[model samples]
Target: MTNKHSETSFFITAEEAADQLGVSRATLYAYVSRGLLRAHPTDSDSRRNCYARDDVVDLAGKRRRGRKPVDIAKSTLDWGMPVLESAITLIRDGQLYYRTNNAVALSERASLEDVACLLWDLPQADELEITPSVLPDGWHLLKAHYAKVPIIEALLPLFAIASEDGQTGIWQCDEARLASGAATLLGALFACITGCCPDRHPLHVQLATAWGQGPVGADLVRQALVLCADHELNASSFTARCVASTEASLRMAIIGGLAALSGGRHGGMTERIETAWQAIDPDNMTAHIRRQLAAGVEFPGFGHPLYPQGDARAKALLGSILPDFRFADEIVETMRALTGKAPSIDFALVAMRRYLGLPEGAAFCVFALGRSVGWIAHALEQRRQGQLIRPRAVYVGPDPGSSA
Candidate 1:
């Protein structure tokens, strides 16, 4: 196609456009064939083509789904468009922030309750206290029923009980009441997991006491809870928000979040890393790492797509624990030298739990406990917006009349 261009307009040659998209010229031509791009004939020669620099730059951010070019209408779902707007959290520059505050920095000193208030935008000056209470009667039978099951597995029955008992009314509360209820829910979950009554102490101290640790463990638990509090539109958070959008109770919404978090890809990520760490002999760290590398097996905790340089959360948590623990330092240093990649938050959590001699699924439990706060905050936010989060689907199914 012949097109007129102004002298001030920006344009790039075919080679430059291909380089910009990180694709071969043949692939660029295929894009042209698919009408995703148009080649403009220059005044000097029709054979020489020029493309709009703006168009090339825009297309650079797009990726072909699977082995095929995505359908034009559906392509926007792949990071091309904003599905929803939220004022809660942001993931920018490979760092996480809650509202306007830096989450990592806050994790150093803020309790999980403080972070929850920040997330919910509750008045900072108000008394933010969650009174711990004894479980209701016959709860022991309920606890006994799930005692032999995994901690996360037991969460489902408790969720049902809370919903049935109308405890899910927290979502329908005012901002202040909602914050208080959130704290109570978090404390209750912890109590159920450890079989200890919720203490009036700060969440970290309570967790440390329940886990049979001292001051150092309390500090680490605090940091872990703060770090794990919230991430923008993550799988579980999205699930929570979606349920809330349906006018479900806060407990139901959090239950949805917990269901999603239990998947192997989410909080269960730590379990995989812990299993791998358990298999390796730390005495022969180098040899074991090399063998795993040679076998073409990927170490779970070392790499993360969101943080190409490294996960700041991992860096902070590892730095905090490594000085006090020797094996953790060795595992971290060896993994870094071997993979040239830093440990992810998953890896750091498993390392901390192992070093502290916590239970088998402690890492996952810690994550779920902390993330419940975020889920509550998100559900409350979604409730205020009063909008359903339904997205349209493009069907590629066969026609019903097609008998051939």
Candidate 2:
């Protein structure tokens, strides 16, 4: 009998093999038959086979190298290539690093403020001078009138007002002044999200106090914030860089990032995951998952292309909370068993919100708050490069002079 293999084993199951190869099961089997991949029988089920992960990765790398330049360029937008360079964050070999520090390791002991300082290349959080900004005129009135609005939506106008009311000379500022502005803007963002004035306490503590959470909940919030601080030029971060390249104020760059992140496929994914979780029948999770799959419902937070093995941030956060949240653990196991995918950070954030009994949109709020740190980092980096982020189109449309 063959030995059973876990997810971390050198051998991966058939579904993972196919996914890594970007091929169908039949194609994967064909590869095995043609001796391009090696398959081993599983001990739990003799009929099922697993492929050697090294073989799949090697074949995938060769296939990638053989692709056309245009194909590679198109794939770049979908996790294909490194479009630009940054020293802020690196996702490699299934681990996430912020600069030279491991993000997961930092999350264990550092606060979001600490990660911000690290990503911003500052010596200490004190350099940020993270004092809350005075609210814009009519800010309270706007909040009271739009009290039922989603926090992300409500924040847009608030940021606009703040941007307009404050100094618009960020593009000409030195690093010290820029850092001060970033710190103030971050404090203001926290105030907007939590609907309370921030004091001298750390941002996570302020958030926890606003939400009525205790010390344990505050620590969880800290971990989530630190983990979500940056992810190497995600959509929102890219948007931020583009705006900053135009010499826009840091607040404006952050505004662009917020707009990008509000999309359902980006930071808004937390809400989708929350909704999906609500639809799931915890008692009959596997059956419900199968039914959802049969109906062509895409599970929102199960997979990430960057980490073909698993999202380490998700794993770290989930590892911390899953032992206490039995249903969440079941969902993670059932989803992996059914789809050969693992929970993403989105899933972990939603699970954390549920476990903490926070309000409905708390997950997204946490994401936006934490990710603002990254936006600031990218903005500062782009400003230093001092180049406009303009890309040429491939001109797929019909020629303008052609009458056809």
Candidate 3:
């Protein structure tokens, strides 16, 4: 064990800290800005800084852990056992929090625009007003390319155009520009999805009008949008962060999110559940489910690992509908009996879309739209961190000298 003198000698001067870490003064300052280091001001000269011994040792240990192959290569992409830190969102116990507010509770009062501004730390505005004049001119091409494709698929080309919109040199771009760009991208995508309404209303209003629903329908749209706005470090949000770590444009980063959301086990799970629900004969729900099970088919929307009791988003959304819709009530009852689990967000979205008379595949469209706000929020945050997210992999292929 070390003596008391050695224990008190742990704190070091700025030059000593720099030499010990083997990093330049500028890099050291950058670390401080990134919240990776803490510096204390000296009594005689405030300009001269002293770093805590434990903090420096922790940073050094993190650097070593990052370099070690076994630490990097332990795959936990499904539930992310490897904790990737972000200030964007947090899930505590069973509730989800976005920064300082409870997400499910926030959805009870806030609009999707309010949630977006809150997540981006913009000025407190009740709504995000995006003007139509900033709309990209490539809608003609987008219409041609995605004429026969699902609206979710069209997001790829739509974002590609938005990414090249006069925003140059990403590293120097400011927060206002990023936020405005996100608003425009969201507004334009909504226009494309809903068959191009000319009214420049708020996002929920535009969607409500496009689907020909009045106040009741608009309320559902708002609730779903708020609930789906963000989930902490989910697959798509992580993809957005990864792209932004490379200093990619916000649009490109959101496009990365869209690509990940299209995967079968992520957003595509909603599509599968929608298909299953459509096939159900509500009058004879039990017989229908039994037939499906006898045929070795498993229903997709009944359970979520994160919400064992039930998804709060699903409960809030489904609660609003089950009281009114007879068929939806039957579907829920049958699913619960078969699996002993409650419906998830995917199930709620599909049921809500059907209740509103939206066309098939509209559930995925809503999910993608609502989640785009989260993607942009994450991208902006990742940009501020200024760190590349390249996790290393352990090599297990043939040796360098071995022949194929």
Q: How high is each candidate's TM-score?
A: 0.78, 0.81, 0.77
State the TM-score for model 2.
0.81
**lDDT for each residue of candidate 1 in 1-404, tens digit (9 for 90 to 100):** 23467364577789999999877665575455335677777888876888998888877765544324345445535433234567777655567778868889998899987888788776432556656754777776888888888876777576555334445464455654666666667767776767666677787888888889999888998999899999767789989999999988887887899899888778888878877888888779778878989899867778765567888888888888888888778877887898888888888889889888887788888898889889988988888899998866666799888997
- Residue-level error in angstroms, candidate 1, position 171: 6.8
**Candidate order (TM-score):** 2, 1, 3
Q: Give the CA lDDT, 0 to 100, for residue 209 in model 3.
A: 83
**RMSD of each candidate relative to the true structure:** 9.6, 9.6, 8.8
Q: Candidate 3: which pairs clash?
A: none
**What Cα-based lDDT does every candidate model obtain?**
0.77, 0.82, 0.75
Q: Judged by lDDT relative to the true structure, which candidate is superior, 2 or 3?
A: 2
Task: Find the candidate with the highest TM-score and give its number.
Answer: 2
lDDT of 3 by residue, 89-169 (tens): 765445667875888888787788888888886532335665563446766666677778876677667656644557545
Q: Clashing pairs in model 1?
A: none
Model 2 gets an lDDT of 0.82
